[model samples]
Target: MHATKGTPDATRFLELLRLSVSLVLIIFAQITITGFVGFFVVFLPFLSSSYSPGSLLTGMKFLIAGFAFALPWLGYWWMMYSLSGNGRIRGFFLLLLTSYLALIFICMQIDPVYNPEAMIPGSARESTFLVCMAMSAVILFPFYSLGVYIFVLRPVKRPRKRYRFLLLCLLFAVAGLVLLPFLWHSAPIVYPGLLSFPE
Candidate 1:
């Protein structure tokens, strides 16, 4: 078997972009669902207490959550724009998506709303939502993964400073996973008066 080493296919990279766009759209749809249709689910026993156990989770609530959850993935895609190596690009994005989803699931378990009964400590309904979302995200990974590889193959040189910033962002990305638990645990206590549906 011969290994091919060179620039990635531009068409394939475009496909990854499309996949990323689709994932973003899906996240938006979830925002709408949790916002507009969430009321019914919120009223339900497990659904309400499951993820939004702390306070009422309105449409806006899910919108922000979805955006925040998707940020890491989005940031990663953006970061790829800076580099021109297809292999590194693909590997990095794959790592980013996987790591981001992992952190989300971990936070769900650590947070309150996800698992209300406290039957399982460090596990909640948020985790369940993330698990499902990650499954959906899995469908798009291949394209984005290919994009990363394509990126690495491209011919270009990065500035030293930009490289530094990319490195910083990468570090931040890793730190996000470590810090997510603390953020989830402290968010409610830090900010009371969570938003709710109109009375």
Candidate 2:
């Protein structure tokens, strides 16, 4: 009797552990994808031009900035996932957020080519962008949490279906798109220079 009783508990614990590990893997994958995309986009412009010491240095700076920008979001996602206790919901939210971030970063990279002033480090515009990104994160966190709670956690008359998750994802994507312009406007410019670069 005791052995049978313990089996289910042990199995449940193992299942929770598996979910936790899977979430961590997803987070790491997100970070890796963002880093690769950032590096490639930043390096793309230099490919057509003659190699210069400055271009090489700029590429390295972009890579570092990409990682720095992504690390905070990783923590935020991990915390949200742990709190939500719904791997599917967490995955959806992370996907949405990562896509939004990648899009913004790509735009930032392209913007500097036409308007060099946009990428100037430590400038007011750059600072506003960072502030806006941070603000977006703060604003979206609760919205996602509540969304998961209402859509997935709360009891409903109808049986929960996979399509509901898809719906939630679509809704979030739309909301993200609606707010993206504002976010992008306030987004910190990623310059091809080091943090210590003279203002």
Highest-scoring model, TM-score: 2
Per-residue lDDT, model 2, residue 153, is: 44
Against the true structure, whose lDDT is highest? 2
List, residue by residue over 1-199, the lDDT tens digit for candidate 2: 3447436677668867866675665556545654554454334553332322234443343334433444444454445555666553444554555545644544444332223455533443333333333344345544654555456445355657345544655565556545545555444343333233344
Off by over 4 Å in 1: 1-57, 85-88, 92-97, 104-199
lDDT by residue (1-199, candidate 1, tens digit) is 3335686777778978966764565455434433433233333444344453233442234334433434444444556544534424544444445544543443344322433345743333444333333332333333433433343224355644345445444544444444444445555453222211111
Worst 10 residues of 2 by lDDT: 46-55
- Compared with the true structure, all predictions reach lDDT values of 0.42, 0.47
TM-score of each: 0.27, 0.32
Residue 189 CA displacement from its true place in model 1, Å: 26
Error in Å for residue 102 of model 1: 2.8
